[model samples]
Target: MKEMEPWWKRSVVYQIYPRSFMDSNGDGVGDLQGIISKMDYLKKLGIGIIWLSPVYDSPNDDNGYDIRDYQTIMQEFGTMQDFEQLIEEAKQRDIRIVMDLVVNHTSDEHAWFVESRSSKDSNYRDYYIWRDGKGAQPPNNWGSIFSGPAWEKDELTDSYYLHLFSKKQPDLNWEHGPLRNNIFDMMTFWLEKGIGGFRMDVINFISKDEKLPDGEIHHEQGYGDGSTYFMNGPKIHTYLREMNEKVLSRYDVLTVGEMPGASTEDARIYTNPENQEVNMIFTFEHMNLDSGPNEKWDVRPLELVALKRNLEKWQHALHEVGWNSLYWNNHDQPRVVSRFGEDGAFREVSAKMLAICLHMLQGTPYIYQGEELGMTNVKFDSLSEYRDIETLNMYKEKRQQGIAHETIMSSIYAKGRDNARTPMQWTSNGGFTTGTPWIRMNTNTSFINAEQAIADPSSIFYTYQRLIQLRKIHAIITHGSFQLLLPDHPDLFVYKRQTAEEEWLIVNNFSEKTNQLVWKECNLPQTKGNIMIANYDSPKLEGDMVEVRPYESFVIAFERGK
Candidate 1:
């Protein structure tokens, strides 16, 4: 089979949480104009693609995830003309636009769902899942991702409808042929409107098991019985292929599936070039490094070796068949400097190190909003202070279970969506916007805002600028293969990137103390370069090997002849 083009091979995608990115209108929320004003900044940063989060018309139940209309831009975000202008402006700067496609479910207020729930025999009724109760109880013991039972009883229809997330967000019935076609039509509509592709939200969840059997039960939280039946189901490929053939294949669109529970093998079926279903799938395996087997909410001191091992496993497994979208933070994730690095002290050094560690690997790097500035999570004192639906629901769930208020508050501070959703810090004069921000800005804005970072050459901003340039300039870093070097390093993270012509060793000290690795065992000759890029003030090269200072990182260019 001919090799299909991989989007991650040489791509640089920038994710924008539209509401918090910038507020052009003084309505205390970001709109399309805000993004337009910042186009030059993204273009200057060398961003190839801009992945805009949902700006569709919505009830804001899930903050635009619960979309009401797929065709119209949300009034709060501005009109269709504004979105078109933004797209035109972005394209002029050579940046492709990718919009969020939250097709897993729609708000109950959506015309289709609203009509579906109105009557039993309505044409739109089959558009959603409606089942009879099990003798006054739900169909099964499945739990919603938000909290409580996945099924919500509707008195008007005398049936329980399925909602995997918030009750207002009802799951769509993909098995229905007409409903599937409608979704395809909508997708085609967007593609015709100049959208490069979609960032599929929970695409794997769209295909559930036909049987709807209950999943394995858990102790504290109830099991998602329906999820086991539905997620990565037998008919998933059939549905995806249909969409690909009818809508996606026609346009040179890029699709990245935000798949949560899919295995590497399963993901390969969806993303492998031969499969042709999608360009890539975002896996949560590495992101869940801090969580327990059951996904406990508590924090565990990060295990770097284990993290490295997991990443290496994936890199080796998919090196040939599929591509990985390298990212440490996204809108749904806590800041990388906080979660992966020592965000409090020595943050500058560790932030640069983490950036080098991920960016130097063989894959496309996704830079989340404010990530280049080493942004940290905001500290909120109470649940009331948070605006995210997920965080608020978790707080309530924990509180009802008799968890201490302080304990719940601490978890919110550490794991809340609001952590990543906070407004981007642009300047010190309330860096986010002219009017008050929709959400409070992180207090560290005073010290870590963008204007200062951009002006200072040694700041994380410039370090990232160099990283992007390196990727753009080096063929090996973009298309070469990766091998984990010295996987068992105690305090250091080391890896090698190699192509036919050259090999580059990337080493970094992820801890507070200095560390050394003897490269003699690896049989690689001592490397030499004019200090290509280093995070520390000074790196001492003693004879053959180099010692890395606390949280320092370096990418030393090497070649056989030199």
Candidate 2:
């Protein structure tokens, strides 16, 4: 059995955006108590880990990513006691909690940032990047991840400070030993407090490109190669290895890095089981399918071949060397059904099909809140209704550049973070909380809430429940070797998971039209085994051929001696 490996590699993780999960106090905001109240539901869903979004004390500049204090829960979420209670309750149900660690930068209001900004000569000033502007302008034309110039001029200190996210999130000078030590100490502090590991936020961006050279300017966008300098730098591996040695190695914890722009080779380096920096790192190659060469947000139509190719690349590339964090939806992505499948007309069928495609594959499956019930994107008529800082800044930047409102709206509809940040729907009343939620709930909450999904036997929620159960029951899906069966099928996505005992053929109809699958496509004897699972209630099968419905998904499991 090869000892079955660690639980994280085989477990199912669920992400909860605290503000929108459930509002327990009726204050219109979701809190730790709200999460506590929902434990039994998560337990039933078979989630092994609950990767919670940041609930740390913050000014909410980047919505809690800019932390003012790393040790306490934000007032909006509840007290430290409340968080501890949530942890206790989750443990009772055997669900581990992974906290969000936004370590790349800190809020301008943080004591460290304040001290660093007070005077260039201050001892803490070395904690942050402070440089004289290039002749009254920014040091370079490098742009912020959010928008505009990366450098912010400090009138008090007469120096320009670098902020990759927002002016409020000043980039920490990780090159300084004292600042790095502070970060390491904070991580250990939380671990000592009975907390599990972390979901590191853009942690690779800590090491900056010291040259700060403004590379060849992009025609429309001004910056070039800045991310290359800051992301996955020389010190990144050193810092991560040190953290593993000092903190993570001491505890049985799960760490997933937000390593944006990481390639397959990078993943191997970061997650090589022998001795690597972290447990796993998230890559963005698959997530960038819709964007153009410019990497701006654009909703290009998704091609099944391209999607399958990307999935196969990562799945096969990391099979023996590293592991993958398999997911299609998260805090930054829109609902899977709405973005990847038919949402309105074939919502139920398509949702189930998408889930089966990912869940049965070889990797850990991550289900974001409300994804099981087939949540859709919010339909906002005006940009004023948007609350996300990144979306708002992009809007402002485009508008200033003479971009039309419709053009901005088109991008928002296709690629806005608000699509995923909308409140979770508990019922048709849109009452994610008793009071008004900080962000508006999506309108479809009326029909697609958790209450309704749990009641329906064949709903996407239970479909996922079964799929996850199947993965656990069948070790082949968990750790078996995978082989993509048909590489060039236009409307079909097919693959096989094989182990010494059993071989499973997984097929998906990635289209809205019917497709006929020949039995030969499966490369199995007709009487080998029974159908394990299917998205459609009654699939049309004739002897050696199977007729698939629109967005149909099925798994056929064949044991060698069956």
Candidate 3:
């Protein structure tokens, strides 16, 4: 008998933000041609899957997330033929393409939304959530994730529509059977085109509470947290099961849902193979460890205790029945090296440390573009320099509340989405385009660019390549049991992975100060083990004590019971 292997189990995925990845034809924006040109680069990096952010036709209100048409490609991204060519080129490199699926909402300019709002009695009117306001106010005090009332008034219909995000993006009504069929049909259309799979955006929020009711106010501004009503709502599991049975089951592909506010309990059910909902899930609990008391915009220093607790909880909870999608940097997040590492003098070592710390865990790891090169956060001098709608809206809200400008700007610098959306540093002007870039290029490109890192053997890029190769061939890294050690250690993250024949010890010093690792506490033999990988050239391993330098990381493999 032979073992059946899932392609995603040992594969490493690299996420590309198309608009910032590269630009072809001097358009000052990235396109499919640019991605096709980078096929060799991704292949050399040892990435098997490429997760590209949405490139569907849109009004560009919320970037390409507000899809205007699922069947068509965004004009800025090039034609459908260009995309087909990209798929072909990637296939030649043995890389699979996974698209961003944003079915939660659509742009107001979408044909369905335009017709749904055209008249109260339109056939498509029921395709969206609509309600008559309680007098002049909205139906409820629900707040938008982008910072305002969740309801938007439509003068033509004399009703308010639910929009959890920007007003230009109207939420879809999953209660309508025909609407769900439409979504499934659209998904099948792309799957049949030879695309690998999908990375569903805000997928858990598709279902909502049956009764529309006011929520308790959590912020001083009087807006309520309506996430309880929509996030992981009553019929989310049912919808996912239906999606799986209808379209996903027929194809061998990966499906990962971006689920916010989801707990380990919810994840077990959402991703359990028996349930057939999805292959894995991307949870935000670990990412929110540094968030302030009230909101994500209120930034604070990352705490080791909270970070370890959240990560270990997910790892243990999903070890038996479900899977995890590991990542530290994404389009919606700040750069990992800047957020949790020393990005100033020790950038290279810290970036490598963060990569090994996350990649060695028992999950499919995702590397955001520019992350392997140790990209740091952009330090814009003024709010006018920012381009993200979420950042601009929050700035307006904070300014109106009599908050100090400096304080608000500081928080934005620490938590803004733009910190990750900046153009990839390739060369002067980031090599993103010949013309002007859509967003201002980070000035640090002179030193932090890929052109420089590719030439340096000791750069973060090379370290990441080796880590990816390790995961591909190491059985323990893929299917071993994880046990977190030194849970109380403030600066050192230590863990052990054990398989039937091999045991591995992984240690990472995430701070700028040297940390002593007492091997006696590890309960292993005093004999040295094989050094599988390490950020530094030589790490000292004394009899009972090992001195880990600032931002040092290493993985040692030993024969079990040796």
Candidate 4:
């Protein structure tokens, strides 16, 4: 008999960037009470799981990612009681809440970090990675993801602490058994709070090479690529397995690790069922395809062929061994329509097309907040308009290097994280808050708001709802075998998902130019099956040929040997 699939495998997850989602207390910041008020909205969208970005007590250095307290809720968000109520309210609507677990690092202000930095002999000193630096330089040439050196000196102790991200966020020492246990205890506290699961933030980086060797310098920036020493590090599996056995195994919960530099081979071990680590992992390969040779801030056009190749590699690699977390937009990514599709002329159609292209695959689909409304990237004319640390750092670094401001702005337009953090356009103020917002809302909110999308049946929001409903009713989307079709086609992303009894042909025109689909190339019969879903008003299907309009997408279901 076949094994039963987990709930997460069949569920469609919606990611909510808490700070920008909604605000209830008129504080110009979104809060837990705001999320409680939007349960019905999420339910209407057919979202089964809500993967909320970090809402724990934080200094907002990385927008809640730099967690300070594991048990408390951020004051700007709400009280712990408000969070509990939010969970209960969501549970009533059958929407499981998945908390963002940021165990890899903590804000430097965290009690442990404060105590650790107080003295070299402090017991908590080992709780974080602290090393004596060479004369005046850092122990190594590693650079932080945000910019500058990854190590920060503690004047009191005359030592440096590792921080892969912002200096305010210091990396935890997973090598310390007590530190690992403390993390596990925190997980248990949340699991016991009745939360359904966790979406671990850069969890793979928790473990590191103990030697702390210098990385090879690669970029025009003088710092070395330290990802090799930290990301998917030597003891990552051992750490994850321990995490699984200690806290995760005791609960029936969804767990997906955010692995920045992970490959398909690493995914095999991280997500394989027998390994008892995580249910799935979010890989950055496809997301980084459009990134230029130097870094993400270096502007580059989207290459459909490269995107297809990377996606196919992941889909096929984990098809049998592990599960995949499918997503195009997340808290850390720019808006999908603006990045990969036409956000001006054919925004709705392109958004729907991109949705169909990803959702039909054999993996759990994740929809970022506001993506259903065909949200485009924010075009901030001035760098001061940006809020993300990474974006600000890149802007500063590029300017210091004497790179043209226009060039940096163009790259920010395409890949800035702030693009995804803009207030959810619900009304004139995007309905995100009654007062002034922390960050500016996208000016397109007048037309692209949720209120407008919900009223229009033909809008991208409804299209996403339909796609999600189809995933629930169709087994092929969840467990069928995936095959890439028209691999050589430059403008068309075509693929097939097959099972023993059913087959699905998913064709997407990725470009604005109309393309002719030679059905014969698919090796299917002349008889057309039912059109499961399509973005355009009407799709043309003739004998062994189909006319695909600009940014058009369709999924056709066929029976085997029919």
What tens-digit string does per-residue lDDT give for candidate 1 at 1-562?
9666554467788999999998887888988999999898888778888999999999998889999999999998899999999889998998889999998899999999989999999999999988989898887778888877899999998899989999999999998999999999999888888988999999999987766777677647665545667778788888888889888889876788898888878876887867778888888888887866664367566788998998887787677777777899999889888887888778888899999899988667889999988999888765567898877877778788899988877766677778899998888655567888888888888888888888888999888888888877888887778888778886888888877767777888878887776657445645554456888765676765667788889877677554
lDDT tens digits, residue span 263-317, model 2: 8888888888776577788878877887787655766877788888998888887
Regions of candidate 2 where Cα sits further than 4 Å from its true position: 1-4, 525-527
Q: lDDT tens string, model 4, 1-562?
A: 9877798888999999889999998888988888888899899999999999989999989999998898899999999899889889999999999999998899998999989999988999899999999999899999898989999988888889999999999999998999989999998998888998999999989888998888889887899888888988888889999999899999999999999888999999888999999999999888887877768776578889888888999999999899999999998899999889989999989999999999998778999999999988999878888999998998899899999999888888888999999988886447888789999989988888888888899999999999999999988888899889888889999999999888889999999898999877887644558899999866887766899999999998888876
Give model 2's TM-score versus the native structure: 0.97
Each candidate's lDDT (Cα)? 0.84, 0.85, 0.91, 0.90
Put the candidates in TM-score order, highest first.
3, 4, 2, 1
Clashes (candidate 4): 1
For model 1, the stretches where C-alpha displacement exceeds 4 angstroms are 1-8, 223-226, 526-531
> Which candidate has the top score in lDDT?
3
TM-score winner between candidates 2 and 3: 3
Angstrom error at residue 506, model 2: 0.8
Query: Which of the two candidates, 2 or 3, achieves a greater lDDT against the reference?
Result: 3
